[model samples]
Target: SCPLILVLGDQLSHSLSSLRDAPDGAVVALCEVAEEGRYVPHHPQKIALILAAMRHFAGELRAKGWRVHYSALDAPDNVQTLIGEAERLAALYGCDEVRVTRPGEWRLWQAMQERRDAALPWRLVEDDRFYVTPDAFADWARGRSTLRLEGFYREMRRHTGLLMEGDSPLGGRWNFDHDNREPLPEHLEAPEPPCHRRDATTREVLVLVAEHFGDHFGALEGFHWPVTRRQSLVDLRHFIANLLPHFGRYQDAISDDQPFLFHSRLSAALNLGLLAPQEVCAAVEAAYQDGKAPLNAAEGFIRQILGWREYVRGLYWTRMPSYKRANYLDGQRGLPDFYWSGDTELRCLKRAIEMTRDNAYAHHIQRLMVTGNFALLCDVAPAALCDWYLAVYADACEWVELPNTLGMVLHGDGGLMGSKPYCASGKYLDRMSDHCQRCRYDPKRSTEENACPLNSLYWRFIERHADRLADNPRMKPILGNLARMSDARRTALRKRAEAFLATLDTEPAYGQGAHS
Candidate 1:
């Protein structure tokens, strides 16, 4: 009998290593295990999306003449665990070995390693879905004292021959980030993202999710994510045609009326294996070559996939098990109730959280500067913040989310992922967004009752960590500003922050619903 090829939920790509060149008569196995959906209290829509995609992928394989054995979550005889299902299927088929693509998460990878049997051998194939392999990234990082993303990005550009002219970058620059931070003008009209309607398979998964995971952290009403390869491709094309032209100019902008704001919103599809990174990058490059989009827009979009996404995955694989526990700032406060409820007077945070709850999506700025910045300022524990990020986002998986949350967002890795903490005052938010205008608190005031909490919290964080961050060359300017402030003013700011922190747990309702 042919060996059984197991496909994990996240490994839904038809080009996946285990599925590539699959032998005649090979049995492909897929399952919806309860443990995975409940592992981190994943958003209800996220669970539904994965299960629906898995079901659709299995059907696609069967249509291609492969023998597929699928176990639905509601199956009467379901084992409720991947290992148990694998063992049962292996015995039923009298298979001597099992083949699988390597899992993305460390816990799943370790589980596969521990469950290996000498009699029924397990063969783990390389997951070639990523642009760079883990071994290759490790090789690249071997001699570097600090593994910065820009250098790696340049190497990726050279390796892929993307936006390269002879030995130089296309526009004679490695980063177009400076061109991508303009705030969205009120008169500018942004295109809406493509919304994929749920099919029968997705609808069934939605019913199951609603019944089994009703108390999960997010709403399930607006669950419009693409759940199949075909739908994902449609979304990609739609984004390229309608949005890519202005993506770079307003990529960093925040707005009170828009949730997507000319963003691709393709991360969920990419992370779920419905879209390949190489193809996405190729399409963007083609758009630039064809004059549909400019160099800055194309390069900026490609850099995310070719640079940040790949870099974070490489970092996760290189440093894991211990990386999750890193807390450079020694932050130990519990995550505030507002994170879950969105019930706070901070208008920026409330809007960001509400959007996340409604759509399982938030632009990068909202994640890094709004919620993430608040966590850093208030000294919320890194582990707690990491868990919230992993649970709330539809695109989250440990490999991508861990480094982003612990290192970039929380600065918990002490500067491995980013040179400086992405800490900011309310004035920064006010300048970049319309939320501050509608907000009751004054962004310019730090010591008054009607002052924005972030203003005082920002100074409080700087003052508390000055001793540890003083030597950091990037932090000298901020430290100098702190030093210029009078001792009396500093004391007052600290007192205001302390009073706000004390009332965090008992704060009144801000927004109500599953997300809040």
Candidate 2:
């Protein structure tokens, strides 16, 4: 027998480093361990999606004449931990060593490092799936005092030659973010995403996930994530033809009923290895070249994958282990209970959580402006909100989610990931969404009983972090207005925020899910 190759749940791609050049007679271990799912209270659909995709990928490998050692969730000998299962399978196969791709999180990467001196040696290979490798990003950040994304993104565009016209961007500019923030006009609609028919493998995984992880948060009823490479390709095509044309125009728009308006909804597939970022970007650029979509839409969509996604991964790899411990604002409050149950009266939050509960998905704006903004305003602890975001989203891997939650969502990293906190008042919600039309609270009132909680909370956050935010160019005007407010009105807003917060609940239903 040859060496045993350990394939992780998320590393399901055929071209994964551990499997791409396997020698003859090698055994690939695909294990559905319980520890990975239980480490945090992962959403039911997320667990199901991972297990189903793993099974399907194992089948694909077996069909291609590779020997697969699969340990299903209910197998009697299942050891319930990733390393244990892989080692157990290695022993069973009589292999001397195990080869694996370096995992996406700091904990696992550290664990793999510890395994170097084990009885049966383990080898870790670089997962070079993204546009920029970790070493390359570190080189780019060696001398900078601040690691800004715009600078890194520009480098990525030039190095990859994406949308480049002889050292210039195709649209004569770098970003189309300004052109992509219009509110919905109420006449436009989004087409339904491609409904993948659940094959026997997927159905079996769904039943297993429901039985094994039923108590976990989020619904398993509408499980529609792409489980295999073929289905992911189909979804990519559908997004290009149906959704990409209008993606840029309404990328930031929110509607009362539309949960995924003009968004790609492809992050889950992209993160899971069913689709590659390069292919996705190439398709969008071809659409622009063929005149199927505008330059703004093409550049905006490409920037997400080719720019932001890669940038965040680089940040995660370089800044983690200590970066996750960063909480510059020193927020210690617990995450509110409404985050888990979606029982709040704030329509924006309620609706966003409802989407997370029902679909295990929410677009970037909903994540940033709606739920994330509320958590930021409430002064929720970085770990608490970070765990919830990681547990709830299907696309969340620690490398991506940690930076976003700790750095961007809560501003817990002391302006490292973002220049200023993304805190927003209800006026922003009202302008960008139709949620306030039917909402009972008024966005314009800050201290009244029927006022939006975010209005006062926003000001309260401003007051709490004023000393740190005073120097930010983007925050100067907002802080100046705060300075202009009368002491009497500021006190009233503070008291009102305190009163509302007293009635709210922030206890975690689950245990402390550490950022480690």
Candidate 3:
């Protein structure tokens, strides 16, 4: 009898212990199914990237003489559910048991559990890929009431010895956030981004995705994301030498023209398991040691991978199933139609959506502040907004994307991911990017004919939801701002916002129900 090994989408890491001592005849399963993609109405490009990368990875494993049971989304053999497919393969192979690493999403993990003990002996091996383990996080959360990130982050530094100097942080400070917010200087030159030649396998995968998911959002013409460890190393080296020097400075800053900007575009690779977090962190550490990058830059870069990245993963494991349903502000507004199409007149929204459509990516701030903020201020329902984020972004995984979209962006978790809704008028965008300069809407007016849509919408959102929101400690200031408005001013703001919302019927965003 053979032992069957199940590989989930995000568990694409080669370092997964389930594959460490694989027997010669072991069966490995990788699937691309509609269930995975449509569960969240994933962006067309995000779907393409994962399916393409998975196909490439399966080919590599097959080249190593491993038996790979790869399933395309439209394959006849695909039943579209992991449990059923796993049992079918195991029964065919005459395997009495299955071995696999723990899954990332709580729903998938639960799905695996219900099926694992049904027909065979199942061994759920520990995932060795992440720096922190489930048990380690559980132990940390044991005696503590609140799992605040800063406290956990400091502990992780002590445990991993990253950014630490003899029991203290190297710079006598735990966070360099104050130094990390310098906006992109006009003359700041970005380094050359790395590119990889698409092998025959990847090209074939691309054709399959294009054929099957042609109507999905985003472009696939220049698909060059790293699909293997070898290519991922090249990307890491390229960033260390070229992008890291300025990464810390502009990591939070937004720019309309410079989509990739100076930051490392390695999240897709890192999340997909093409590159190990520790190895990537070590590469940046090496640059600091060799005097190739400044300490502020190097340590800041390292902290993202070693500190925040690991912390987020740990937090996900500690807070599950219940975390997804948290809606702190009780937000229930329908998602704007413009979210699907880049049809809005707001310059910042237009640029951000266009970039997402072109590349299936936008750095953290772009996602959080620009698009996410609009959704938050417009009172978009958390689930609908989160589904949009999950569907459109290439690097999104439920465990990672949900908390960010619902908690941080929407304040749906009531101040868990963020202290307040990441709501801001156009002035913030004007200061951060050049979008305001080109926009037809003026950032200065709160409720004029040509007022920024976001400006009117934000005030309208607060007024409509005032009864539910006025009491939150974090929301008091915004409430005060609203309370100070004269009756005529408030009426004008509501009228302007209502007009903008009414235009959604004809906007590019509401067309075709792209999310459906």
On lDDT, the candidate that comes out on top is 2
Segments of candidate 2 deviating more than 4 angstroms: 508-512
Q: Can you write out model 1's per-residue Cα lDDT over 390-498, one digit (the tens) per residue?
A: 8888998889988988899888899988998999999899889989999999999999999998999999999999998998999999999999999999999999999
Report lDDT (CA) for all predictions: 0.88, 0.90, 0.77
Q: lDDT order of candidates, best first?
A: 2, 1, 3
TM-score-superior candidate, 1 or 3: 1
Per-residue lDDT of 1-516 in model 2, one digit per residue for the tens? 578999898898889998877888899999998899988899999999999999999999999899998999999999999889988888988998889998988988898889888999889999988898899999998989999989988988999888999899987999998999899997878999899999999999999999999999899998899989999998999999999999998999988788888888788888889999999999999999999999999999998898889989999888878888888888778889989999999989999999999999999999999999988888788888888999999998999998998899988788878998999999999999999988889998999999999999999999999999888999999999999999999999999999998998878533235635
Show the lowest summed lDDT stretch of 10 residues, model 1: 507-516
Q: Once model 3 is optimally superposed onto the true structure by TM-score, how far is the C-alpha of residue 360 displaced, in angstroms?
A: 0.9
Summing lDDT over every window of 10 consecutive residues in candidate 2, give the lowest-scoring window.
Answer: 507-516
Please give, for residues 1-516, the per-residue lDDT of candidate 3 as tens digits.
778898877777767788889887889988777778767666666776687778878878888788988877788878887767777778888887788888777777777777656758677888878888978878887887556667877887787787678899877988777778777777765765777888787777788778877777777775777777788789888888888888887877888688888778888888888888888887887787788887788778877777667766776777776677676666666676777788889888888998888888888888989988888777667777777787787888766777788777887766655545678878788777777778898998877788888888888878877887776787898899899999999999899898887776422222112332
By TM-score: ranked, best first: 2, 1, 3
Q: What residue pairs are clashing in model 3?
A: 42-391, 43-391, 328-412, 337-509
RMSD of each: 3.3, 1.3, 3.1
Question: Which TM-score value belongs to model 2?
Answer: 0.98
Determine the C-alpha RMSD for candidate 1 after optimal superposition of all C-alphas.
3.3
